[model samples]
Target: MSELHNHADRVLSVVESSSAAALSRLAASWRRSLVRHGIDPATVQGPQRLTQRELNVLVESNDSFLRSATPRVDNLYALVGQSGCAVLLTDARGIVLQHRVNDGDAEVFSDWGLWSGGNWSEEAEGTNGIGTCLAERRRVTIHRDDHFIARNTGLSCMDAPIFGPNGQLLGALDVSSARSDQTEGFNQLISAMVEQTARQIETDFFRATFPKARIIVAGDDTREGSLLAVDQDDLVVGATRLARAALDLPTEGELRPIPAVDLLGRSEESPKGFEGAERAAVMRALSRADGNVSAAAKALGIGRATMYRRMKRLGISEKSH
Candidate 1:
C-alpha cells in the first residue's frame, strides 16, 4: 500500500509482461535491471563504493582521462551547480572518478553514493543515468520515477557517453539533481548540456592524444566532433568515433595509415588520362608557390612561358587563386 511497494509492483509487472523489444528504452532498462542484473526494485541499499586504495589505483590508471575531463567537469558544474545538481565523471565501468557538488548539496549526494569511487554500472546500480548511458553508449536522462530502483526514484540524472580518441568507450559525463522540484523539461535541457560537454571532452582528449598531428574537421556538422588526426605525411593517424562511423573506418585499435586525401575523396590519381594528372601536378605547384607563376615554374623545373602554356591548356585561371 506504500509508494515504495507500488513502485516495486509496477516494475515487476513491466519486467514480467513486456517483451524487451516491445518496451521503451526506459522499460527495457528496467527489465535488464530486474532480469539480467537481478536487482530488486524495492532495495534500499546505495551503490557499492571502492575502498580508498582501490580508488587510488583506478585513478592512477585513468590519469590522462581524468586530466582531460576534469576541467570540463568543473565548467559544467559552474553552469548547473547552483541548480542543486552534482556533476560526476565516471570511467567506462561506471566507477566515479571525479565528482563536483556545492558544499550545501554534498551531503545529500554523498548519502546517495554519488561521489568519487561509487560504482554505478548497470550491473551494480540498475537503470540510472550514468549506468544506462554507458550501457547503451549514448545520451540518457533518467528523471525521477523513471529510475528502476525505488530508492533512486527521487533523483534526476542526465548522462552522456564519452568515447576516446581510439574510438573506445572512455566513460560518461553525468549531472544528477536531488531537487524534488526538478521537471522533465529541465532535465532535457541539462541532458543537452551533458552531451555537449561530453563531446568537448572527447575533442580535448583526441587533440591531446595526437598533439603534433594536424586535426581536420571531417564533417560539416561539428556537434559530433567528426575529426581526423593526420601526421606530417598526410596519413590519417587517428579518428574520432563519429568520423569512424561516418567514413566506415575501423572503430578500435591502431588505425591503418590511410591517405587523408583518399579518405576525403580527393585522391590525386586521375581516371581521366595524362592530362588530368598533369593538371593536378600543375595545381599543386601553383598552390605550393602561393600563386606565383615564376615560382611555380621554377619548382616544376620548367620555363615560365611553358608554365603559362600548361596552365592555359589545363584551363586553370591564374586569377582563381
Candidate 2:
C-alpha cells in the first residue's frame, strides 16, 4: 500500500510540474482532471452503475446504436480476448451500453466496474479512458497510474471517440486491460487497433443509416473501411473520420452534409435517379441478409411481395445463392 501511494504521488508530481513523461499527453489530461474538475486523485470513488430500471430505459432509448455497434464490439473483443482485455461501448455521456470480456478475465474485469450500465464519465470516474476520450473529443490511452484516480491506477485503457454520420459525437469505444504492467509498446499497439476498430464501427453505422446514399469507400481498395455517403443529387451527405481526413475535407463545423463538389472538387458519377437508389438499397439489404429475400425484406421493413415486385422492377436477380 505504501508503494502504491508513492507511485501515485510521483505521477501527480510529474503532472503538477508539467514534466515530460512517456505518457505526457495522458498526464496532462490527468492534471486538468484534477485541477479543473477538483477531483481528489487519492480519494476517487468507484464507478456507479445505473439501477436495473434505469439501465433498461437507457438501452431502449439507444436501441439503434446498440443494434449497429454490437456486432463490431463483439469482433473487437474476440481479437483482444487472448490479451485479457475488456471491450466496451459507451454512450456520449459515458454510460456503458455494452461490454465483453473473455470468460477467463470476466471476474477481473467485473472487479474494476467494467460491466454494462456502469458510468465512466469524467465527473463520475475522473480521468479514465471513456470519460477522458469524450472530454478530449479525440483518441486517447490512459495507462495505469496515468489515471487521475488512484483507485483506477491498476487499469490501462485505450479509447476512441465514435462520430455520427453528420459529424456529431455519438459515443466511444474502449479497450481496457486490468493488467497494469503491460509494456508501453503493447499498449500503443492496442490504441492503434482500437482506433481502427472504432472507425470501422462508425463506417458501419453510417452505411446502415444512409442506405440509399452512394457509399464510396475511400483509401486503398485492398483495405476495407473509410467511407463517404453521397446523396442521389451527388451531394456529400456524410463521411467517417477516416474518409474526411483522407479526403482533406473541411473542418467538421464546415463541410458536412455539403455537396461533394465543394470538397471533392468533382461532381458525383451519374446518379441513376430514385430507381437507381432504390435498387441499390435493395441490393444492400440483400447483401446484408446473405441474399435471403425474406430476411432482406424484413430488414428493409417491406412486405415480401413488395420486395419481389421492387426486385423485378429494379432487375435484381431472383436466384439467391
Candidate 3:
C-alpha cells in the first residue's frame, strides 16, 4: 500500500481532480517488466556437499594420479596458467585431482575450495562448469547468477570433461575467472581452450600412460568453498561455520593456513613473538604500507625508527611492498 501510494503521488494527490488524463493513465497502468533473455531460469544449480574426509582424501590421493599422468598435468597447468586463469582437475566423483593457480591470484581467489575435492554438479553446487561438464561430458559456461553462494555471484567458469586411458570417465578440467562477462568471442575462446586442454590431457594419457591405442576417452569439469576468509597476510578475517569447524580455528580472526615467508615476509621486530592471529594482520598491514617505515610503524603502533629496525630484521623491504 505504501509503494502504490508513492507511485500515485507523482501523478497527483488525492486532493487533485481527474482532469489530468495523462497522469491518470500513467498512474493507472504503469508496471515493471520482469523477464530475462537467452538464459534459462531453470539453469539453477542443485545442492552439493563435501565432507572434510573427502577433501582430505583428494589431497592425499593426487600424487599417485600425478605420477601416472606425468607432465601432462603440468602442461595443462602451464596452458591455463598462461591466461592467468585458475585451473582445476576433478575426478569422476567430483573430487579435485589437481589445482594449478598463479602465484598472483591467491588474494582475490581465497576460495580455491571450488575445485578442492568439493562436489560439482547441477544438483550439487548448481549449474556450474565442473558439475555440468561432468554430467554433459561437454563444454559449458557457468556465469555469476548461476552460482549457489552469494559471494560467488561475480565469477564465471568454463568446464570440459576428461577421459582415462581405457576410455573410462576420468574427470573434468576447468578454466575459471571472476570477470566472465567478457565478449562472446572471449567465451567462445575459453570453451575452445578448455577443449584443447582436455585433448592434450587425453593425448598425454594415451601416448605415455596407456599401452593400448584402442581406448577412446570422452567428456568433461568449479568455484566457491566455505573456507574462512583471510587477508593477504593469511590472517583469518571472517569464516563460514563450515570453515571454522573444518579447519578448527579457535576464533573468527584466527589463522588456519599459515602464510609462507615468500608470500608474506617474516616479521623482523617480532616474527617469532607475534603468534596466532596477530601475524596475518601484521604482515598484511606492512605490505599495504609499501615498506614505508613511517606508514608501517603507524599501522603497527610502533615508532618509525622501530619499524625500520623491524623491517631490517624481518628481511622484508620496500620492494616487497
Candidate 4:
C-alpha cells in the first residue's frame, strides 16, 4: 500500500475508535478533522486562496491588527528566515494575512499555499499548524507526519495564538518549514520563539488599545503577560486574557470599572472606615511635611491644635510619624 493510503487508514482507525479519553492532542485534532470538518486524510488539494478584492477587504478591516503585528512578524522572520522557514501571520479565522519567505524557498512555500490570502482554518485545511493552533487557541507544533492530511506530512509548523487587548482571539503566528531534515528538537526551540513573539504582539496590541492608560504588571507569572490597564482615577479599564483568567474577571465584553487597589487586594490590607480615611490623610500630610506638626496642619488646611488632637484620636504617636 502507498504511504498516503496508510496515513488515511491510520486516521480512519483513530476516528472510528471509542477510546476518546485516551486520545492525544494530535489524535483529537485528527478526529475533529475527520468527523467535524469532514476532511479526508488522503486529500491532495491545497488551501483555498482568496481573490484580490476579498483579500483587500480583509486587510482594510483588520488594519489596526496588521499594524500591530507587522513589526513583530518581521522580527520573527529575521530570526528564523535563514533556516528555510516561512513565517506567516493569520487572522482569527486562519486566513493568512502576511508572510515572509526567503527568495530561494519562496517557490516551494508558495506551492504549499503558505502565502497571503490562503484560507488555512482547520475546517478548510484539516489539522495543520496554523489551523490547529487557532482551533485550539494555544501553542502547537505539528511536525511532519503529525499532520492529519497526508499532503501536509512533509511540513513542520510551529504556531501560537495571539489574543487581542479585549481578550478576544486575534489570530496566530506561525513558522513553517518543508525541510526533511528538521527535527522535533529544533521545532521545539522554534515553538518557544513563536510563542514569545505572539505574546509580544499581544502586549503591543493591548498597550496600543489603551494608549493613555497606565499599564501595570498584575502578577508575578510572566508567561501569560498578565497586565491591567489603569485610568487616572485608579480604575482598571482593561485586562489581558491571562490577567482576566487569573483575577477571575470576565474574559470578554467591556470589563466593569474596578478599583485598582480593590483588584490588587490592597484595600483589605489597609483602612476602610471614614476614620481610617481621615487617619490615612493625616499620615500622608505628616509624611509630606517631614513630620512637622505645624507644617502638616498647614498642608491639611487645619489648625495645629486640631491636627494634634486628631493624631492622638487616631492613636498615632508623635515619635512614630
Model 2: lowest-lDDT 10 consecutive positions:
250-259
* Cα-based TM-score, every candidate: 0.82, 0.75, 0.46, 0.81
lDDT of 1 by residue, 45-89 (tens): 879999999999999999998889889999999999999999999
What's the distance in Å from true for residue 9, model 3? Answer: 29
Displacement of the residue 271 alpha carbon in candidate 3, Å: 69
Model 2, 101-123: lDDT tens digits are: 88888888877888889999887
lDDT: worst 10-residue window of model 4: 265-274
User: Count of backbone clashes for each model?
Assistant: 0, 0, 16, 0
Ranking by lDDT: 1, 4, 2, 3
Candidate 2: residue 156 lDDT (0-100): 91
* Alpha-carbon deviation at 44 in model 2, angstroms: 5.7
State the lDDT of candidate 3 residue by residue for 83-112, as single tens digits: 667777788766666667777775555463
Model 4 off-target regions past 4 Å?
A: 18-22, 267-321
Provide the global lDDT of candidate 4 against the true structure.
0.87
How does candidate 2 score on lDDT? 0.78
Reference-based lDDT, each prediction: 0.87, 0.78, 0.52, 0.87
Residues 22-128 of candidate 4 have per-residue lDDT tens digits of 27888889888988989989988888999989999998999999999999999999999999999999999999999999999999999999999999899998899
Candidate 3: regions farther than 4 A off: 1-53, 59-64, 68-70, 146-151, 212-321
